[model samples]
Target: MIRRDLLLTLFGIGAGQAILLAVMPFLARAYGPAAFGSYAVIVAVAGIVATIAALRFDLALSGAEDASIVPLSRAGLLLPLLTVPFAIAVLALALRLPFGAHLPFRSDDLSLIGLIALFQGWVLLGSALSTRRGLFATLAAAKIVQPLVFAFTALLLLHDLSLAMAVGWAAAMAATLPAWRHLPSSMGWAETRATMRRLWRFPAISAPMALLDVLALSLPLLVFAGAYGERTAGNYAQVQRLIGAPLVLVATAGGQTFLKHAGDRLRAGVSVLPLIRRFVMVMLALAAVVTVAVALVGQPALTFVVGPGWRTDTGFLLLALLPVLCRVIASPVSHILVLTQRLATQGLWQISYFLATAGVLAIAPRLFGLEGTLGALACSEFLLYGAYLVLAVRAARAANPLPALSSKTRPLSASS
Candidate 1:
């Protein structure tokens, strides 16, 4: 049953990426690299904002008691929703600044940011709600809906592909149910505030951690583009997408299942260390096989599909192998922090990761150029994820040494 569930989830993710892959040629013909660059920046920014808006409360869903889930999820949304106006003000200011030019925002782009951030927050929370309730199909449906809609809209508005990208993103996200759905949705300010306080580490530590991680990833595109040229940045983004497609195929399914099942075990004070160790072994083995296979086939595959100019730039696929391996292995188990409420440790890791990558970007290029710098960054992440795995194991065990818990009582209906 567990294996079947994992395959189903992977199928959903694979199907969505397949659609995006099929539509890529059409999108590329319609919009130039400059437009895609702009779209990438906007999407990256929206991802950052989504993390802030949802406040990492979703991480707690699987472990949270039923009564706590509704109140906590609702409360998390409050911080972001209340700050929406401020976000808009910042968006407006960012557009006029020279820095925003690289992000290539238009007068209308701020609205897209606003719409995407709002839609993404709810979508994230809704997905979390589904996961916690064991509504796996909803999660599967969500994986499909986003790109299916994105492809349709991209085709329909080829003239305004950038706007279509944002609109498609919002449309797909809006299709997900909110975290508060089926709940009475009547928590008073006092209760909401209380709930927020109870889950304070998520918003306070994890949210910023998420944002910094985003900056670490997204800021590079801008920096790379500035240092080299648009082509370099565009190629890097393309390589990332191609590599990420397969990475996400496994990561998404592994992460959701790990969090749900491992969380259940921990909540009952059961040790998942065996599972974590075995899981890590399997991912590392898979990584070794993938890295070697890609090294052999990557260049030929690129030239055949994307044509000749793409051959030189796809080195990133090989360069990123170590980090991608660490990603798949570490990410599935990182929810240990949520289970342990050890956001401070995770926050520290993020800060170090941000600084290390920034340093690598600044220094490695002078000595070895773009490809070498990317490798340096990947090495740093590889080390960080190692530390993460050790910490996660220790934390999970430390958090679960108490007497075993019995089955929880049924959660009260929404009105309670």
Candidate 2:
């Protein structure tokens, strides 16, 4: 079942990656580094907002029962819709702040961030519900539609990268229209309140955990834009996009599958350790293969895809590989924390992750320059995520303790 679900999810991710890879060359040629940099900033801000827009109630939907799913899904949708105006207001005001002058995008792009967040929230809710309901095909379709729409709109709106990205995100949400039909007509205030209370841990714990995780990812882009320049940030962003596509694919497929199966095992009183162990092995093998392949052909491929004069440096790619690989490994089975009700432990880790990311980004650049800073960031994260994997294993064991050995089962002698 896990294999089948993973392949279905991978099918969609594969399609989306193909679309993105096909159009990247055109996008690189048409849009300058400065433009790409600004677009990256827009995405970064929108990503952070979207992470919290639903207060992570969407995650709760994954393990919800049939009768409870509708109300939870409805509440998830409503939260983001309600957040839209607040997001716009806060972002608009932020752009006028003194530090706002250091922001990468112009004032006009602030609204796009809100739009992107709203749409992303919709997609998030849809995906969780779809995964819970075993609608991998629908989930896959949504993935394909997002990149397809983004690619087409991006080509058309070559003049406006931010707007094009927002449009593409909007399309992803639109593709989830079918999924929304599965929601309640309207959750009552009492129902919404009750649901929120019941799932309080998600918003209180999971939301912040998710927000911190995204911020860790987004910090480098924002810092790069402010500290380096748009062109430099753009170059870095492009390298990330290229290297991250496959990671996203593997993470998404593995995560969705694990969420479904692991949740089942936890409910059935089965040990989740075996599943977690399998995922770790798969991710490690994949990371090793990807790192070697990219080392071999990443630079030439980047040059061919995005053209010359745009700093498609292999040094950055190589430095980014280790950290990204660590991330991909942890991300797939990280849900074990949630399934095992280890939110507090997960929260502590995420907080440490965010702080470490900020510190490294702030100080490392000054000491070692861009390449050296990336190397530092990569090494720090390797340790952090390595620790996280250990925690995951412990959490799995704690949640599902091993049975005691029977007296008949004697240990074998070393000589034997």
Candidate 3:
């Protein structure tokens, strides 16, 4: 079941990402590093906003009961409306403030950022609802629709890159309308409050983890822009995006599958150790392959695809490889922490990771220059992910009880 579902998702998402990847060279030529850099920051901010927009109640969709689904869906739907507006206002204000002035994009991009974040939340809601219903095909189709729409809209709106992203996200959200239709038109505030109480961990614990996780990912782009410059940020953004595409594709598909399966296994009193082991091994092997391929061809490939003006180099790829591979291995399986009810431990790790990332980015750049900074960041992430994997394994082991021993459970005899 996992293999089948993962393949369907991978195929659909792979195709969509392929389309996005195909047009990227052309887009790079049209927009150049500066614009792409700004777009990366906008997208990063939108991602952080989207993570909180629904307050992460959507995560509760894993194996939710029918009695609980409507209110959860409603919470997922309406929370974004309230949260996104407030977030957008805050972001807009930040853009006007002195420190925000360090960011490359103008305040004009705020509207696009808000739209993208809102729709992205809706898209996440849809994904959650669909996964609950086992609607993998629908999810896969939506995945394809997003990047395909983004590619076309990006070309058409070459004059405004951020707007194109907003349009693309909106289209992706539209594709999930069928899933959203499953949501109740209304839920009483009392019911909503009760439901939130019942699943309080998602909001109180998982939400913070989700936010910190995204911030950790986005810090490099944000820090690079402020400390380095738009051009350097853009160059980093281009390489990061390229490295991230396949990782996202696999993680999304595999994470959804594992989330559902692990939840089921836990509910049935089955240990998820074997499942976790399998997933971690597969992802590790995949990451190793990616690291090797990138080590060999990464620099030349970037130069050929993105053109000479961007200054693609082997040093950046080498410095980035360790972190990227570690992330690929650790991220998809990290959800095991949540499934095993280890959110607090996971939260601590996330907070530590974000702080460490900020500290390293702040200090490393001063001493090591660009490559050294990246190397430092990579090494820190290597340690962070190493710790996270250990936590996840321990949490998974602790979630299941030890088997009982009895005369009936004795080892098989030679003739038995």
Question: For this target, which candidate reaches the highest lDDT against the unseen true structure?
Answer: 2
RMSD in order of candidates: 5.2, 6.5, 6.7
Using TM-score as the yardstick, the better of models 1 and 3 is: 3
The C-alpha local distance difference test score for the whole of candidate 2 amounts to: 0.81
**Ranking of all predicted structures according to lDDT, beginning with the best and ending with the worst:** 2, 3, 1
lDDT of 2 by residue, 1-416 (tens): 88888889989988888888999899899997888898889888998899889998888776654556766877887899787668778878878899878777677877888888888888888888888888888888888998888888888855677777778778878777777675556547787677677667778878888889899988888888988998988998888887776686678778988988887787677899999999999998989898888888888998999887688667778886678898889887888777655677888899999999999998998999888888888998899999999888887887742221112222322321
- lDDT tens readout by residue for model 3, 1-416: 88888788788878887887788888888899998888888998898999999998887777455667778887888899999999888878887788777775577877888899999999998988887777888888889998888778878755767788888888888887787665656657688778788677778878988898888888888888888788888888888777766676687778888887877787677888898899889998888788787778888888878887886667777675567778878777777766655667878898999899989988888899888888889899999999988887887877743221111222322321
TM-score of 3: 0.92
Please give the distance, in angstroms, between residue 155's alpha carbon in candidate 2 and its true position after superposition: 0.9
Q: Could you tell me how far off, in angstroms, the CA of residue 17 lies in candidate 2 after the best superposition?
A: 0.6
**After superposition, candidate 1 runs with Cα above 4 Å error:** 76-78, 94-108, 178-181, 185-189, 307-314, 320-322, 401-416
Name every residue pair that clashes in candidate 3: none
Q: What is the C-alpha lDDT of each candidate?
A: 0.69, 0.81, 0.80
Deviation of model 2 at 330, angstroms: 1.0
**Mind giving the per-residue lDDT tens digits that candidate 1 earns over 193-282?**
766666666677777898887778676676777677666666666666666556755775777777777777766768888767766776
- Residue runs of model 2 more than 4 Å from their true location after superposition: 184-186, 400-416
TM-score of each: 0.87, 0.93, 0.92
What local lDDT does model 2 show for residue 110? 70
